[model samples]
Target: DTAVSQTPKYLVTQMGNDKSIKCEQNLGHDTMYWYKQDSKKFLKIMFSYNNKELIINETVPNRFSPKSPDKAHLNLHINSLELGDSAVYFCASSQLPKRLLAGSYNEQFFGPGTRLTVL
Candidate 1:
């Protein structure tokens, strides 16, 4: 079984439509995150949830929302999708890293992303 999984891996829609992507992880992690990969392949974090509580990245737009119903599931919603919203959205899960030295964290495990296209 996959440790992390996403639904409806390919989404193609018009510029004004709204859509959602669902994610689930069986890894029993305490933190979950959403990341967006642009057409240029630049990956950036959008939101993070720890123990079902949200910790939104300040730079993320209000149009993007992340909801975690439980520690194992997280979903992302996008409203008024625009051409600029077209990107591959990835879901990842991780646990609090052990204090390696002072400031570093362990790498997160990413799921296969959902590719969204807005035309």
Candidate 2:
């Protein structure tokens, strides 16, 4: 079984259309993250949920939102998708330190990724 999985491996949509990417993890991790990889392959974190609580929300547009129904699931919803939204969205999970101190690292399990194409 995949430790992290995302639905709709490829998504092709027109501009201004709304879309959502569902992600789930079977690793029972305490934290889940949403990342966007641009055409340049620069991965940037958009949002993170720790134990179902929102944390580490980057300076993403309000059109993007992440909802976590539970610790094992985190879904990314984009409203009024724009051409710039065309990128690979990844879902990752990890068991993190409760206090989030410096120099602490945990291996994150990443999903296959959902490629969003806006035309």
Candidate 3:
């Protein structure tokens, strides 16, 4: 079974339209994240939720919103989608990172992603 999954693997819409993507994880993790990959394949984190609390990336525009109805699920909504918003949106999940003397790292498992194309 897939640890993480996303709906509507593909999304095509015109500019100015709104869209939403849903995600779920069965890994029983407490932290979930949303990431966007541009045409150039540069991945950047858009939002994160820990135990259902929002932590928006400061650089992300207000047009992007992430809502977590529960710890196991996270949904992303985009208002007034633009051509620039065309990209693959990935949902990921990970447990809280633990501090260690060497450092701390949280391994994130990513979903198949939803490809959004704005005409």
Higher-scoring candidate on lDDT, 1 or 2: 2
State the lDDT of candidate 2 residue by residue for 9-115, as single tens digits: 99999999999999999997999999999999999999999998998899999999899999999999999999999999999999985678788786888999999
Model 2 lDDT on a 0 to 1 scale: 0.94
Candidate 2 least-lDDT 10 residues = 97-106
TM-score, structure 1 vs. true: 0.90
Q: Which ten contiguous residues of candidate 1 have the minimum total lDDT?
A: 97-106
Q: How do the residues 1-119 of candidate 1 rate in per-residue lDDT, one tens digit apiece? A: 99999987999999888899999999998889999999899999888888888865759779988889999999999999999898999999988533234665756999999999999
As for candidate 3, its clashing pairs are none
Work out the TM-score per prediction: 0.90, 0.95, 0.92
Candidate 2 lDDT score at position 63: 99
| RMSD to the hidden true structure, all candidates | 2.3, 1.3, 2.0
Return the candidate ranking by TM-score, descending. 2, 3, 1
Off by over 4 Å in 3: 97-104
Model 1 sits at a Cα RMSD from the real structure of 2.3
Residue 34 lDDT (model 3): 97
